[model samples]
Target: MMHNVSHVRFFFLSGFNETVNFKVALFSLTFMSYCVVVLVNVALIVIIILDKNMHEPMYILLCTFCMNGLYGTTSFYPKMLWDLLSPIHVISYSECIVQALVMYSFACCDLSILSVMAYDRYVAICRPLKYHSIMSKQRVLLLACFSWLTPFSISAINIILTSRLKLCSPYIDRLFCMNWVIVKLACFPTETIVNNIVSYVTIIIYLFHGLFIVWSYMYVIKTCVNSLENRAKFMQTCVPHLTSLLIFLITALFSVFNTLFGSTLPPTIQNVIAIELLIISPMMNPLVYGFKLTLIRNRILGGITLQMK
Candidate 1:
């Protein structure tokens, strides 16, 4: 028996099973949401780029974060919209792997960027004198590249490893292609040892990112407690980053848990939780930064007021 035989050519996505009756309504809502996401993120990016005043490292990082949100959402929204409208939800094997890669990398990059942002805040708050020297433009650019490239490389490797496996099934219970879900379809469990090891290493690495964030903020909060100036700085800057981090973690964790133990829930509820990260995080991040960050909020409002005139 050729254990490596891969007969699967397509994957059936059943995440939309419950939405058949309301597909049209869901499509409309999703379409509007996508548009809003694009508009806000692009608006923020343009504001940061055009206004030389907003070219500082922190704002630049925020722009990078918003751009990442756009990248991640772009991978999911179009396919999701198509799935919502189509009677049959199917994705080609190659495309499914690519989509899974993009989705996973996008998420991992988000955490990487957030981790960098946390460090940036830690430096700006804790080591105020050296913030500029430490987070220079060249360095920020390098950090941004690291955030994007590292995760993309990791995800690509995972996808490549997954491609070698012979899948026993072609159905993905969730709406989108996930690496883990695809791995679950492997014909033989023994083929997955490398995949599992790599996945665990990846998780540990990103988990360090989460821990770094917690530690960074602990010092930040403690530092702020002693000084009125630092407290105001923390409120002014750290809050938005904290909010974005909180939103990302909540959505990502829900999806992760859903993937792990969602069988007990109704399919509709499971699907919603599974996709909340892709939908809510993209839309919410821009809104959170646009409203919470004073400079960004002012720039956005100023742009609106100018266009009104």
Candidate 2:
């Protein structure tokens, strides 16, 4: 029962750590991760964009994953960096609210992109001959557009409803900017409404996405069993996608566990899992995909060498 308030705002207590040394280390690590995450994803996008040889649907979906990585880092890096550098870490009420929404949106985009990638693999493996006709350039473009648009629409709805509420204090409990934390901190009666909307969004994104992934793998398994020639390629494709999904699912599970079990796990452990699932997963995607797929890596290296030459 959150009230529709326009003029109300909140104060965020960002200076949580008393030790200066901790802040310095946090800043250093954040700086390094931000650089690496951006570089790797940008490299992936550039490789796919420049290499006409790699203009297949799989690479196109990989490009979307790279974009999702950028969006994911953007949602938190700015504030985290700000908090690390300044002696007193602080964020405005509106800023926190917007960050919350952006966090969810980025998250939504990430899961959606991964789901699309899995589907791409399914098409590539299960329907090899029809892959080209089915996943034509136009269709790939349409799918990419839908991936972006779907998340943006859902994010907009969640944020619009979220922004309508009045937050008492912006002192969110959890680390690294989360919607749940901010929403929980907001002293509003209609917080339930916000949570309910979030609940609905979560169900829609994760449930359907998870179901599609399971279905894709099911078909993938069937294809694997029937085909002997391209078994290695098909299995390789499934590995990274499944690895990424499992890592993501584990993180989601922990968060749900912490919330439901009320076990009072240390916030540090929770943050570590969050960082692993967010920063670590995106950074690893390029390597995971590249190492597992010979063609992708070769194309990337060839693209780099060609540039240098």
Candidate 3:
């Protein structure tokens, strides 16, 4: 079979910044974010894995959060930071497709995991009498498996579909190869593909995930209102999740707006917001749970020291 990979030469990037100072600022911010992300996410994963006390479903879900954060960091950071430091900001055509796939694939996976977490919380709370039976170890394992595998299948589908397309030029509008930008570069007329992606993005990525999270929270809240003891513990657990979902939701919603409306927001302002969103998870996630939340810090420390012995 003849390989149809585009014989494209140069991949032109409408990189994040144009001016020297803007580039410098971006470099400083992204570097700091990458470091924080690596340190905190790894620490969270280790803490949860080492601590026997942290082996419950809630904490296990939190551990998956750290892993997802790690995936998120790797998906976007290294190549982007390299571009910031270097003068020539070009990615090979093949590299662009790979990067786009990695970024979106991880993003979709994160959504799946978050949805599982939301449902987990709902089961644990709303169905208290049956909670143990409903969220047994076997069930948790099943949910986890589904969460990781489902998006992976979709990502594979997308990669296979995209790999079949032909390309005339490699000029992409975004700093990186966003799905929107890549689809825009298709040589052939792409109404069906574009519409499919946009509709899927709007419905599944935005609407489905968004609605599920909110619905889960509603059930959680109803359950909480009907309960009496352990109210504070419930609050503690809910707050971190709420914070994570909000950050993710706001960024996704903004991205949708920018794509649909052609954000009149200046590029400087937009890039700044985008950079902050990209890096904020590193600091926010750990601080929200371990540093501020109860039992986590001391338990994590104790768990680490015990492991060393």
Give me the candidate number with maximum TM-score.
1
In the predicted model 1, the residue pairs found to clash are: none
Question: What would the TM-scores of all predictions be?
Answer: 0.97, 0.88, 0.86
Put down candidate 1 lDDT per residue, 1-309, tens digits, no spaces.
465757899999977788889988999999999999999899999989999988898999989998998998898999999999888999999999999999899999999999999999999999999999999999999999999999999999999999899998888888889899999999899999999999999999999999999999999999999999999999889998999999998988898788788888999899889788888888888888889888888888887899999
Preferred candidate (lDDT higher): 1 or 2: 1
Which one is best on lDDT?
1
Question: Number of clashes in model 2?
Answer: 2
Q: What is the lDDT of residue 191 in candidate 3?
A: 33
Question: Tens digit of lDDT per residue, candidate 3, span 1-309?
Answer: 245566675687765445455777777877887898888888888877887877777778778777777876786788888888878778886787777676666667667777887887777667768877887778877777777777766676666566566667766656677665565566785633743674375356536876888899887887688676435546767777777777777776676676676468776555545544456654587768886566688876777899999
Which rank order by TM-score, best down to worst?
Answer: 1, 2, 3
Error of 2 at 18 (Å): 6.7
Query: Any residue pairs clashing in model 3, and if so which?
Result: none
lDDT of each: 0.91, 0.73, 0.71
| All candidates in order of lDDT, best leading | 1, 2, 3
- Measured on C-alpha atoms, candidate 1 has an lDDT of 0.91
* Tens digits of lDDT, candidate 2, 31-146: 89888888888988887788798888888888888888788777777667877677766666677667767767776777787788888888888888998999899999898888
